[model samples]
Target: MTEYGPRPVDRRLPTEEARDLMTLVRELADREIRPTAAEEEDAGHFPRATFTLLSESGLLSLPYDEEFGGGGQPYEVYLQVLEELAAARLTIGLGVSVHTLACHALAGFGSKEQRTERLPDMLGGGLLGAYCLSEPSSGSDAASLTTRATRDGDTWTLEGTKAWTTHGGVADFYTVLARTGGSGAHGITAFLVPGDAEGLSAAAPERKMGMKGSPTAQLHFDAVRVPDSRRIGEEGQGFAIALSALDSGRLGIAACAVGVAQAALDEALAYTAERQQFGRPIADFQGLRFMLADMATQIEAGRALYLTAARLRDAGLPFSKEAAMAKLFCTDTAMRVTTDAVQLLGGYGYTLDFPAERYMREAKVLQIVEGTNQIQRMVIARHLAGPEKR
Candidate 1:
């Protein structure tokens, strides 16, 4: 079979600087990420050093404000960078996305003092972060989360468990949500908690089928205390902050999905061109050719959809619906395309000897993370037809 390598995506970056950024990202992915991706992933090793390299290279803070140590790139450029990194290794790409999400509340809503004091380190000072919103009992109905934060003078003590945190044990900081007053979304508040706080601890990482290199775990806050200065936005505004961050985060997931789909398509194309059957390459057959064409088309469409949403976000227009649409379509496309890639590879695709099976396994989680595909549909419908009546 022909040797498989990442095909350089023809990106339509707006500025020369953005183009240069893409080049740097591609070089880094080739040099520091792609080479050991399979091995590290197979060994379930989190590439902390690789993340440090990304931080030093300024890839970790692409979409935030420059004054706060961000790269000041538009979401369009930032997301394309994510796609490239994800094509090389999903763990790195998704980790960056989660870190960005973790910084959202503070970056977007914190006071100037808070941003000046904390944003620089969180953004580019080599600090990894995690978002804490989901709990064991509340996943889809996040408004019903039971985590509580009680205020005593200038200190807030948090108590509860947050489930499915992406960088649970390894993060340097966490953006946490907790109920401050009564039950439901309006009573919730957001806080920025240091990872090494006395009462903060992580449970064992969840054993997952794929993306094993990235830890997903539950965090228990046992009277974890935070100064009032660490509170992000006003009390009872946490749910809104969380939802706002997720709207952008869904776009990140969409980009990662396209990356996975593109990688799978590339693999299938390489394998089909060299694998011969009945005295001709499988790629020469019309059926397989059609399959390849469909895969490529879906990937292109998904890319375009995400870019459209990103452009909308950059222009400061409403993009919640578009973000939902992109997340839904792109992740579903990844699932379908990766499955077809496995089919094209035949028996080899089913084994760990080839990356196709790994791609297939990895694609399955995209449909479930950030928000489930079912939730994406609900979000889309809420925009089109209004919220469902209770």
Candidate 2:
């Protein structure tokens, strides 16, 4: 019996350590994640224990600095690990991405004192995280967020709601962005808030078409107070921090999309080679063969696109534009390739019996998350054409 998911992906990593990391990730994915992914997803199970296991294995902290309890891996290697986990189960992949996004503000902009005090627990302390930037009225327009944080003496009180938060209710901490100055992007600031802070609560998770195992909900803050020491960066620097985080976060999304597309292609290839059609294998048909070839090609192209952007990021070059392009192209590829995988499977693909339909549904969200593909095009165009005139 051939494995119907997560085929080997030849990678060009810069270090032998990275090669070993990938091997461990694949072994864990096959043993701990893949065999039960469908069942757990169907049950809407969050797999908190699995996240703890990942934390203990150092998988959750691969891309950050080693001084802060991270693995200190390059972006390229980290993204490949994300692709592997995502290929097995998207909830875990996207979960790790969001957790990293939540840590970005403190890791990149927090003071030395802050890092010394709090960095260890966030990286590998078995505590999950959530990023709170998008509001009900502001997603693509993140700077227009209305969540307010009013400073009083040495503390700040946060009020208003944050929407579309992944890991909303379950996270141990939240990296929140709120209006601390005026109305525009310059007025925003970031804060690290504990999950159990007074006056902070999460609404029921959204009933979505896919990714049910990962919770997405609204977080309400009514006069929640935190000490000034918990604030990340300077006042009115939150938008810049949020944008920086999104640039990296988009690459994570791109990697995950390729994983899903790769998984779908693997399933289609296995099924086509076995299922007989009119005394011949379906894989023998020229038309079916072409579709499989196209799917494989698309997955490869998407993987390469994301990897190129990741290398630029690791080299300390400006990668926002390339990240946007990768996010846009890779997600679209996942959507197209997964749809073709369904078609290749014929009647069996439409039902829940096979994973093709699930992959198709999951791929749709990748286009919409980490900024919609439409928003990505706008970012890329602005980088190319420059920002619009007043």
Best candidate, lDDT-wise?
2
- For every candidate, C-alpha RMSD to the true structure in Å: 1.3, 1.2
Give the poorly placed runs of model 2, Cα more than 4 Å off.
1-10
- For candidate 1, lDDT tens digit of each residue in 1-390? 222355545456999899899989988988888888888899999999988989999999999999999999999999999988888889998999999999999999999999999999998999999999999999989999999999999999999999999989999999999999888889999999999999999999999989999999999999999999999999999999999999999999999999888888888998999899999999999999999999999999999999999999999999999999999999999999999999999999998877878788888998988889999999999999999999
- Superposition error at 140 for model 1 (Å): 0.6
Runs of candidate 1 exceeding 4 Å displacement = 1-11
CA lDDT of each candidate? 0.92, 0.93
